[model samples]
Target: MNFKTKLLAYHAIAAAIAVIPMQSMASDVEIKYEKFPLTSPEAQQIWAAESNDATPLGEEKPWAMIAKVKVPGKKDLVVSQLFSSMHCGGIECPIKIMQEGLVISEGMACDAYEYHELSDDHEALMACDAIIPLDLK
Candidate 1:
């Protein structure tokens, strides 16, 4: 085919592809997790790496805090974020660790967790593979 004919064919194919939506690609995949209550007993006993009983959090390894987040507009819908270790920045928000212009758990892997939100406990269904020991202390 001539150069002009080839150019027209290429342009037509490009326009057709642009009009079609790619079903494989997701449009929205945003997930948010807020810090869980540290005062709760479950928060004190972390689910990540083990730390010595004598060594207080932040003294040795960073302290991992779980997040209790509920799906918007759904009172009964909730999920937990088993976040990596992060220091408590202050008393008001003891679990809010962004401080001193530094993040203790920076470059850490906070997985997209899936679990059964219970009234008094949580049951893990599936989660990111990065969860060490597949959810353990």
Candidate 2:
């Protein structure tokens, strides 16, 4: 084979090897929620109560929801994940870390508790450990 052709082939193979693991490492997080459409009025109320300073931004309405999930062996674990359109009314919202109902560390933003809105590249359901609507009924 010509030297030019051989060089091109080597580059292509090297590129393929480098790309494959990055694709694998970019794994999709699997999230399971208790219900779809979260239609319960009670559930909506609970979410509203949890939302910290969630007021509508322009025409965009603020919202929240509660999620009941079973993670592997941990059955029926209820963890509240909140959403807000506004930034905590410019207040430093304390992020609580709890284990079995007792706060292990307070005011530390648990990586799991960090909030992000839904987007095309990322699913809100997947981004959050669990999802709660920002509004209550």
Candidate 3:
């Protein structure tokens, strides 16, 4: 082919690539959390230590779940939180973030939580009931 035609074809290819999204061009990673019932003896121990037995009837067990978080190029994270009909009252409950069975973070309250891997840093987003979302680093 002539130089002019080859140059035009190269320019067209470059233009198409430039318009494509950066994410689609790279390996796409899905970030999400999965909840599984907390039924292990270890989980029970954690609940007993943190629950404080606030409920009027001590017999009322706190509903709990372990959240497994998946992040790109990282080990799965384990989160412990109370849920269902029996959770700590108001906006706060005991929350724990763990990796490899080791606690990385512990907090009093977070009805909802999310982790973000930003361009230059990482952060956790937490929201309490009836309260504004907090951007935590």
Q: Which candidate tops TM-score?
A: 3
How does candidate 1 score on lDDT? Answer: 0.32
The CA lDDT of each predicted structure is 0.32, 0.36, 0.50
Looking at model 3, residue 107 earns an lDDT score of: 60
Scored by Cα lDDT, where does model 2 land? 0.36
lDDT of 3 by residue, 1-117 (tens): 999999999999998786564323322233244443344565664465645543422454455556665545567666566643345556466666666766666666554544321
Q: Per-residue lDDT for 1-137 in model 2, tens only?
A: 99999999999999999767444432233333233122246335444334445655346454333344333333333333333435333322223222354333333122343342222222112233322221111
Off by over 4 Å in 3: 1-39, 45-48, 51-60, 83-87, 112-121, 128-137
Better of 1 and 3 by TM-score: 3
Residue pairs with backbone atoms closer than 3 Å in model 1 (clashes)? none
Kindly report which residue stretches of model 2 are placed more than 4 angstroms away from their true locations once superposed: 1-30, 33-52, 88-137
Best model per lDDT: 3
Order of candidates by TM-score, top first?
3, 2, 1
TM-score quality measure for candidate 1? 0.23
Q: Give the TM-scores of the predictions, in the order they appear.
A: 0.23, 0.33, 0.47
Worst 10 residues of 3 by lDDT: 128-137
- Residue 105 C-alpha lDDT in model 2: 30
Candidate 3 local lDDT, residue 9: 100
Clashing residue pairs, candidate 3?
A: none
